[model samples]
Target chain A: MSDTTESKRLTTAQDYASLIDKFDTFLFDCDGVIWSGPKLIPGVREVIAWLRTKGKNVLFVSNNASKSRPMYKKTFDDFGIDTTDDELFNSGFASALYLAKILNFPKDKKVYVIGMKGLEEELDAVGVAHCGGSDPAEMEYMPAKDYTSVTPDPSVGAVLCGFDAFVNYKKYSKAHTYLTKNPGCHFILTNTDATFPSGGEFYPGSGAMSAPLVYSTKMTPTVIGKPNSHMMDAILASKDFDRSRTIMVGDNLETDILFGQNSGIETLLTMTGVTNEDHLLGPKKSSTVPTYIVNSLGDFKVLVDESK
Target chain B: MSDTTESKRLTTAQDYASLIDKFDTFLFDCDGVIWSGPKLIPGVREVIAWLRTKGKNVLFVSNNASKSRPMYKKTFDDFGIDTTDDELFNSGFASALYLAKILNFPKDKKVYVIGMKGLEEELDAVGVAHCGGSDPAEMEYMPAKDYTSVTPDPSVGAVLCGFDAFVNYKKYSKAHTYLTKNPGCHFILTNTDATFPSGGEFYPGSGAMSAPLVYSTKMTPTVIGKPNSHMMDAILASKDFDRSRTIMVGDNLETDILFGQNSGIETLLTMTGVTNEDHLLGPKKSSTVPTYIVNSLGDFKVLVDESK
Candidate 1:
């Protein structure tokens, strides 16, 4: 184990010659890698422009499925970084595509969704079905935050999980009971972020909602957000891209590091996200180490430019 | 699902004619089915005598791996039922055998066991190696509770989880960390009983110790006890048993019923155990339901006598 002071004092920026020589595509995690909360990190725009001028592809990836692709593009544009819907990847979008491919979706395959407006809008754009009404026997129902309108049915094909403010104990208990009674039913959680930064203090993330079900039913959810390969696969299958030339950049180890490791992509870990130096030193440090560590997105660009 | 009242009313003794006709060897669950806590349930002794008189094989089976075979045998003998060590099947006993067979254990395999004196005795009797120290750094360590100890070496050959009194947060965090670092290391849990009855209150069981690791590492433990076929195979493989004729009788649906269901042996459900009418009406009450629902163990005598 490395000494704490030594690791912290070690410059996050170093020679990127080898790393730049190895990759063409750049994937950036939104929350910490590019911006903290709604504010853009310093020198993030310049790095994107540099990458674009170097003819490298850039994708703005986020595991927060609460936001749509358009929302992501808007956020990047608002932050003075150039991006488009085509260059955005959200787990909710990927999840919709995944379910669509497997279930042979109908315009009427009423999906019981539990998420924010962005997720619902994405589902609507995909022409997938949705159900959330007063009827208790309905085949589909959407529960967001409170989900007072939604009642569980054994026939509900799948339960979708995402970010929402209306969630409460009743919703969780119902989901638990329903899934317990019917183990064959599918459970799709957007992501497993334990806590997400809000105003001042940290608020519980989708992990809080999914943890109980996972514990009780002993089921591993098929996550469809940032750092998971599900989103990567959806993007690659839709676009004519070379996976070998792709490089993934993120700030969290469990999700981002794991995503890159599982997807066979080069990963650059940025110190701008939820995982701090202490977190790294803790037992949670992944066995799959990052290929590069950077203090900021500016450092990422320096490596890219210098390597070429 | 059937109403609770109706399900309760439906609980009645059925002739074990069909079940006895199918299998000759009988396996009984000790807790609830035969005894509750320290007291033997009514008619338990007569039933065993009747089965023995009819020349049917009987084995005392339980998921509680906290105690050794001799302890259970002693308990039964004290309760007016004569039994041999060979007739007892506990997860702890099976776990030692499993480690001995698969791991190429040395004469002194030096294990870190996190269970009771029974588990330690079983390992000693098998001539395998073990240490039952509380310190994480004291060689190999097993977790008897959700939190017990953590090893700093980051490399232990195996982690055994069983029954322990002092479970806390620190131990779980360390064990989970060690597991993440050394993915190849083995995990052995005595049983997966979510909660067991103790002192008129439900307390977390072996499942609590095993589950957290299983969730974090995404690695399932090599279970050594009930519902798992390893012990059954170990017992039937012994000199006194015949594979072609064995009957497993118990009360719990998920563990006992499913054990018999998967093992291709006839099963009987007694009304005196952990499971009740609620389980019979829930998902587990389908075609996999027990072949017989006897009011008490004494009913077994009638079946055996009739067979004679």
Candidate 2:
């Protein structure tokens, strides 16, 4: 809002329609852009459906690594919006894809998962062997002095972390051991989101879960979610999409808008979630400015109605 | 090392006797200085007794927060060393003393503790009311989505974190809520030691336990242990000790030696524990150089034998 040429506030129906025509592919951030905690943001369904009807490619790119694509598809289905597993690229999928395709991980080696079932499922989907995640044995708290039984598997070539509800001393200890002892072990994290808004309150995110390991091992993991290029690489590698003709739509300016700007794609900021107009115009305006701004995706319904 | 005049390697018995005569008060770091794990370092007891025979004030200053002063005193007793609780200063005691004496916390407000029994005991010793530490209800793993039951007491004015074995999502969630919601709520951490050597292997320390909360809250706690002035302040306030005439003795250069350097007191580094000669002379040489270096505290036994 400091009169930046990149960000133009859309105030008219014609403005919305013209912006819609500029992009052939649309990427949406799940939490704030489309919905917020179990309910769809007003008119998001209509906007997405309208985009699909117009032969525009729509992809749900989320930083939520707690759920796999199939699990995410259930949420879309629950919201009455049509989405396939392939159309959803979440942090879990991005991490799995990055390991399997980009790094070309050894088939004999396994990934030590310090996350949830969703992350493990994605790894399994990509035929990447994994251990430690959601394992009942690892979930139990072991005394700090008792390290006789805490042994690392030599086959673990990578350690991947995401959101795990059962994050305990045992898991961190094992992850620390593997990272320190295992030579050439890859350290990867889905995202470093400090907190995620949910049910009218903020909850600890994946970053909080991975922090203990980072502190103990003194090693920063390769983050693969929003604001990092690994997710973009995974999306681009999996599908053919024109970056020039694509625009990112999200509510959070830091993660979502910045991700778009970093990926060299146009970004549209929506006010239905975490960010607002004041955020862009205020002294604390984020470094990454969106190309366009709208009150909500519901405003685009008027554009769809006008086109009809 | 690096041509520092402060660090003089003690070789001859005359050098050891000269170092002993330089300082009237001797501060010791427990883990590496006095003992390693469950066993006492050789001749450490004789050296301590020898120092006391010369009318020197012996105080144990450790970053370990897992035990209260009395509990720590038991370790000395177990090793056949005569010591009183008042002669010991640990992170747990430092935190409580800082809150009760330095901050002069409001009598009506209770402190929320995210630590073990030792931290709770020290808080109790200072006549401070605290909640959450070692509480069975708080130790249970609550689903990330469920925050309905996790409530903060309105009287909570401080959040203290230490080496908590029962650390879980619920405790972190409640602590975050108290920190964000409660007005003037202070955040305090015991020590930021990444790893502590135990049972012949390094394990995650109190800092690792506090990392999750640090990440989620995005707030750095006032650390009250080695290398921080608060611990030094706590020790100074409790007793009348002349900094010019005192010397800190320990094994770890980063924490123990740095603590002495920050406190304007002389330090002696021994090779009996975590640090060695290479650490002082290598590329990773610590900024805080000790006043004297010896192969072990047992080397001081030569001076005692010569004096006898």
Estimated TM-score for each candidate: 0.51, 0.95
Residue pairs with backbone overlap in model 2: none
Where does model 1 exceed 4 Å of error? A1-250, A253-296, A300-308, B1-22, B132-156, B168-184, B237-240, B281-287, B302-308
Predicted candidate 1: interface RMSD?
14.1
lDDT of 2 by residue, A12-74 (tens): 988988888899999998877787778788888988898898999999999999998898899
lDDT for B149 in candidate 2 is 64
Question: On a 0 to 1 DockQ scale, where is model 1?
Answer: 0.03
lDDT winner: 2
True contacts kept of each: 0.01, 0.62
Q: In candidate 1, what are the lDDT values of residues B1-308, reduced to their tens digit?
A: 44332212223224455555566788888787888877888767877887677677788878877778887788888898988898787888777777776565555236656655677887777777765424444323222232223343433556677765433234444445455555466678877776556445443457754554565556667776778777666565443655557767787877887787777776777878776666676655544477667666655565545555
- Among incorrect, acceptable, medium and high, the docking class of model 2 is medium
Candidate 1, residue B145: lDDT: 30
Query: Model 2's DockQ?
Result: 0.67
Best by TM-score: 2
